[model samples]
Target: MTKPTLADLTAFSAVATHRSFRRAADALGVSRSSLSHAMLALERDLGVRLLNRTTRSVSPTEAGEALLARLAPVLRDLDDALDAVADARGNPSGTLRINANESAARLLLKTVVPLFLKRFPSMALDLVAEGRLVDIVERGFDAGVRLGESVPRDMVAVRISDDLRFVVVAAPSYLSGRTPLITPDDLRNHDCIRQRLPSGKRYRWEFRKHGEEMAIDVPGVLTLDHNGLMVEAASDGLGLAYVPESTARDWLDDGRLVTVLEDWCPFIPGLCLYYPGHRHVPAGLRAFIDVLREVNH
Candidate 1:
């Protein structure tokens, strides 16, 4: 029995990931022939064909996929460990991948990231603005930001912002000739600006007051998917838009948009940073969480 070498595993991993010897060689900064020889040596030593190769392409065998499922993380951890040791001697340094909604990312960039970066100059932050839910760990993300209620129960979460409220508003010009909507029932007769979800269904306008809550299936002349676009269209006097109160505050203050049925607007859970409970969080993530606690506390 012979001991496996790091080079053997790395070449196999690279080829498995790239699915082409030429691409794998480019990624590993080696010649194609050298990479092919290394894999052949590895297969000879292991006495198994780990990869199925053809003239035009390369693919992993069944055993290769299982090996990849196990080794990919292990190799990644090995690389991370090396970086950690180097980082410990100098500064807290690593890329922090965070998935968040566009609004939260905007808020963090405006309010949180400046302070965090001033303190840890070496850290890199990749904040992805995505509306859909993501499996942070499986997707190689350090953490995710979502509404408190939207966070998965299996993950640990820390509050980053206070409660949020949603408001229904329309541009002053658009409302000039239209009758004011005093109640949710009035919205049915108005040209509401509706938002479409990622799944292509129109978002239902919801309202609540005291102890009663209801969803209004209001008709609209225009529909959009992005909140930023919805706000812009409403500001241009297209139609009424139901949006987060915080997002509409500036427009409302400027008198460009008028809030309607304020009493019916509901306060909901705000943004939270959530991560897997079972895994050891990286130093970069720990530092971010610490800053969140300090700021929100």
Candidate 2:
């Protein structure tokens, strides 16, 4: 008797549900040719034609339909049983992969993880501190953190932080000898520490006042992609930096970094935990999101 493999079952199930090799291939993140080949091998092993393939479409044969009908619920129960085990543990146990910008990740590290671990000590968090917006589904991330405004419409987002403001801050030593910059336009002459986006482009500094918004491509001598690095450089008097007010709170209180253009900087949306819609959200993820909501509340 030939033993059934999980891969064979998964491939069969995907194709059965989608009814098309191309659609199944797209969902499984495999080439159409690979899916077709797998089906062929599966048919060969069983000595039966499972699918009636045509130039335009593919449909399961009667035997294949019967097999799928018997297997689907069993597979579903297997998955549910595994999930139940994870849920029965009460505390999540597994590696949670997340993609986020440097700033958002820092915020999460400071506030979210402590509480998360308190509730679910066994869960391991792997954070990729990146500046690029990654496709969470394609990249295989459980979730991603981003600024609320930056999250796509198709994604479901939960606000993790209150509205945050970006402020222009400079080391007291750097501002000592320079002319005081009261307006956003004054940034044109000053050396600002710029943030280079992951797309190999400079991030424009946006300012708004009295309902008027403007994006300024400020000239700068220092540029970095990491927000923490930019903060350090600004603290060392490299140049004025546009940073989140939350991050500069310590520097501002201690008189290390002076806030400039305070009126121009206004509160925008804050950090959000976002993920794809329609996908089966794991129980672990559901619990984590609930924790986030409780903490935020």
Candidate 3:
């Protein structure tokens, strides 16, 4: 009997972890047919039916589950060992996958991305902009970027920006005939543009004044998942939008959108780069973090 090679183990573990050949193939940057062939070959060599497949889903059999339980940790340790060697070389060269929200991605692109790339030309960055929070480790990402307060307590977080502020703004045309908004409650009577979270829940507008905080579920004619689109909607006279002030800066500066209720807007903790505390920091991630600190400072 021949021993299973590293490639075979990696393929099996990816499929087992995701429970979907298509997802595993995508993650591995391989074709679905190729992944299927690898798995079949692995099963043939092992002489066991390791996976139970159906039209809708795939799950590992008992033998496969046992194998997976052992392989995951071992693979992580092997990768760590390789990373240690790479670190010894004093140069970062590899793909650094990051999962970040739209706002964070925009902030990084504007502030640090160009400099970071110039400083580390050999390193590749894969930035996935998402509206929802994701488990970076499980998703095979090296790190994630999100508001400091939103980061998981178990992860190590590094501040990448100062406080962020939200603002309520609308085009002059939209507010021409409507009553001016004086308080948070006044938003109820206005045609506000709302944001829809990844969980399908609408984001409520939050306000703070003199230590008092209020969250309002503003009535809206349009709801969008992206802040840029929300700003555009407000600029087009669709409705008032409560968005990160940075997102609406250009429109506000150009007199296309006017801000209201500035005193009520709160400055929240800024975005942070976070990663699992237990894993060894790869050279690429370490270099990226250093660049982030340099640019932010």
Candidate 4:
């Protein structure tokens, strides 16, 4: 057996992180063939297969998973140390990856993203918009943006937006001959457009009234995963949609969609930027946080 060089380890780490040779190569600014060769050499030296590669996808094997679990934190620490030095030299530069839902991404793009990029020209931001709550650390993200209540308690959360509210709305055409929705139970009689969560469960519509909270499992014929699509469906006269107030505002104001059960809608804590509490905050993340605070104010 031979000792693995730092390049070998780093390449292996990148491949394991992304589970794709091409993506890892792109991220590392190298050729896929070179990365594949490096992985082969690394595996030969270790005497164990680290990856299961097929024509369409790549994934870590048992040994690779073990190695990845150990390598991720150590590599992050090293990167942080380097970023710290860069910060001291007044040249903070690194990639800052963020996991956020569509609404959060929209909010950041509208308010904070431009300022943050202008302030930290050397830093690269990768914003992944997803519907599921993800493990930011495990996924190699610097942070995640989620609703305050949805953020993990173990992570440090910073408020990024003001309080948010949800609304149930439908186009006039759909509501024309339909029974009026006067209560939460009225949703049962109407054709609702439901949202599908990443976990494969349907998102139940939540409402609040006079200090009491209720979750309604509304039935619907169409199930969409994105909020934008839900709003579109509602506006197209397909069904009623329960979505964030911000998402439906334009449609509601223009009479493309009209709100229902507004009194039952509840104001909840807004989006937040959350990250691991134990690790050192990189300069890029710190800069982003500052911008978020500025925009929030």
lDDT of each: 0.84, 0.83, 0.89, 0.88
List, in order, the clash count of every candidate structure.
0, 0, 0, 0
lDDT of 4 by residue, 1-297 (tens): 999987898889988888878868756768999999989989999999999999988899999999989987888888878987988987678788889988889888999999988887898888889878977775668899999999999999999888999899999999897778888988988898998899999989988899887888998889998888999999999999999989888998899999999999978999999999998898889889988888878
Better of 2 and 3 by lDDT: 3
Q: What TM-score would every model get versus the actual structure?
A: 0.75, 0.71, 0.91, 0.82
Candidate 1 contains a number of clashing pairs equal to 0
**lDDT (10s digit) by residue, model 3, range 120-202:** 78888889898899888767788999999899999999999889999999999998978988889999888888899999999
Model 4 residue 106 CA deviation (Å) reads 2.3
- Number of clashes in model 4? 0
Question: In candidate 1, how many Å is residue 98 off?
Answer: 0.7
Query: Could you give candidate 2's per-residue lDDT for residues 138-252 as a string of tens digits?
Result: 5557799999889988998989888999999889889887888977889999999999888999999999999998899999978898766777889999998998887788888
Pick by lDDT: 1 or 4, better one: 4
Better of 1 and 3 by TM-score: 3
Ranking by TM-score: 3, 4, 1, 2
Give the per-residue lDDT digits (tens) of candidate 1, residues 1-297: 466798889889989987889867755668999999998888888888889999998999998888878988998798779667745874568678889988889988987788788888889888888887766664557799999988999999998899998898889888887787888999988888898886678888988898998899888878888877777889998888999878888888998888888999989999999999877677778788888788777
In candidate 1, which residue pairs get closer than 3 Å at backbone N, Cα or C atoms, i.e. clash? none
- How many steric overlaps does candidate 2 have? 0
For candidate 2, the TM-score is: 0.71
